[model samples]
Target: MSTTTPAKVTVITHPLVQHKLTLMRKKESSTNSFRRLLGELSTLMAYEITRDMPLQDLEIETPMEKMTGKVIDGKKQVLVSILRAGNGFLDGMLNVIPGARIGHIGLYRDPETLQPVEYYFKMPSEMQERDIIVVDPMLATGNSAVAAVERLKQLQPRSIKFVCLLAAPEGVATMQKMHPDVPIFTAAIDRELNDHGYIMPGLGDAGDRIFGTK
Candidate 1:
């Protein structure tokens, strides 16, 4: 196995993930449909990414006899939502990993500066010992996602993986160069970024649909 951290991102292109992603990508998709699809897509992708989590065997008493059971080992995994958009992905992930601890970091871009600014932050205590999965729906500019990871590092989590709904290659490249130690998992990696820095053919803003607010 490679000792180095994975810099590459695995786009969860499974049929179900792809179908839902396609629906969300359409300009004709309504807010309710987009929001519902995003949640479902997150659950599908999260399952694949979390498949290899270490498990420990435990002996259990059954009605007929004693049996062996497997349970996740080590500390509970931490799922951090990078604000409004991230919350969309976080909801589905939480459904799958109901017992996993959750964290939230709210970052928004400033109008004139076009810089990511943190509006709120909270993370599990003793996070250094747990696996961390930071989530956001869109990685358009990568500013907020990068900033969120930078902040998480200050707490020194054992390991971190970023999960997003869609990513532009530019954003992926930026994150790869800035924090090569972090691996990214996204549902789709779009072709390019427009001059305005939005992912080309990207779905409308994830936050708006998820919360039904502008």
Candidate 2:
């Protein structure tokens, strides 16, 4: 196991992200309210995560003038959602980068072993030329995040960034061990995970709350 510290974890401290996360954490927050807050929060987080995207100068004509302006370079970016809950982040991110290609990785954690089990996965082609962003709402045990990244690494994307609404220290450590090169972006890093592997002080089961399945 790698002993390197997780230096790539980015905790989003934007006031809006922090405020919206607070609302989502409330146990009494309604499903609609929670989902709405999550969408808004995801948009904010997306902005932060894409801060370093490459830009290129392009000559364009404006209403009355032609000027060189900067535009995102290269092909449309890719957003891979670790399915079910990861879908919650899609709308907000797509709203920002409407042309981004969408990918899905379906996996569930086995209760007995607390390990991720993959069920489905599909990604856009030409991954080597495009950066990929993997979105999931929670990184509790990091099993799913690690598994998803491991699978994506096989495709050899130009880059990979992991985004989550919440994360735990244990999860961050696990990800650092497995894929330290992949940075982690999240709104908050909550307290430790409980025995059942739920992040304490987290917004409960994210998939359950997002879909009101609980």
Candidate 3:
């Protein structure tokens, strides 16, 4: 359930991300606020996720003269939502990368052993040549994230990254070990996980709050 190994676990903790995550954590917050907060946090995560994306120069004609314009290089970035909660993050990621291709990897965790088993998976047209960024709101047990990434690996994506609203230490460690190649970007890493695999002092179910299905 943990890894003492040093891994690339990034804590966003940006003011905007923090402020929204706080509001989403409150018991009184409404569904609208929860959805808004998730979008805000997801935007911040998207920024970090694409920080080092390769870029190329393109010829462009300006009002004055022809010049070079920046284009997303062959990085071929694609957004893949992990389903349900992952859609929350996808909403914001799309805002930033308008033309980016989209993908979906749906997995539901088994309540008994807390393992992620894929029920459905549909990725972008060409995943092997692209770098996939998988989105999910909560990383409590890390089972879902790891399993999703494991499935993604079979697609032969050049690289992968994980984006989440919040995470527990146990989950972060587990994911890092399971997929050392995939860097994690999250709004916060909470203290611990509770008995039922929920983040400690963490916001209740993100899916319920965002969709108001509770």
Q: Would you list the C-alpha lDDT of every candidate in the order shown?
A: 0.83, 0.91, 0.83
Error of 1 at 171 (Å): 0.5
The TM-score of predicted model 1 comes to 0.92
lDDT (10s digit) by residue, model 3, range 3-92: 355448788867877887888899999999888878877877678778888888899998999999898843387888888888888778
Error of 1 at 51 (Å): 1.7
Q: Give the local distance difference test score of model 1.
A: 0.83
Poorly placed runs, candidate 3 (over 4 Å): 1-7, 73-75
Question: Residue 24's C-alpha lDDT in candidate 1?
Answer: 87
Per-residue lDDT for 76-169 in model 2, tens only?
5999999899999999988777779999999999998899999999998888888999999999999999999999988888888999999999
Name the weakest run of 10 consecutive residues (lDDT summed) in model 3. Answer: 1-10
Clashes of 3: 0
Query: Model 1 over residues 51-169: C-alpha lDDT tens digits?
Result: 77778899999899999999874346999998877877877887778888889998888866657999899988998788898998888778888899999999988788899888999
Best by TM-score: 2
Q: What's the TM-score of every candidate structure?
A: 0.92, 0.95, 0.93
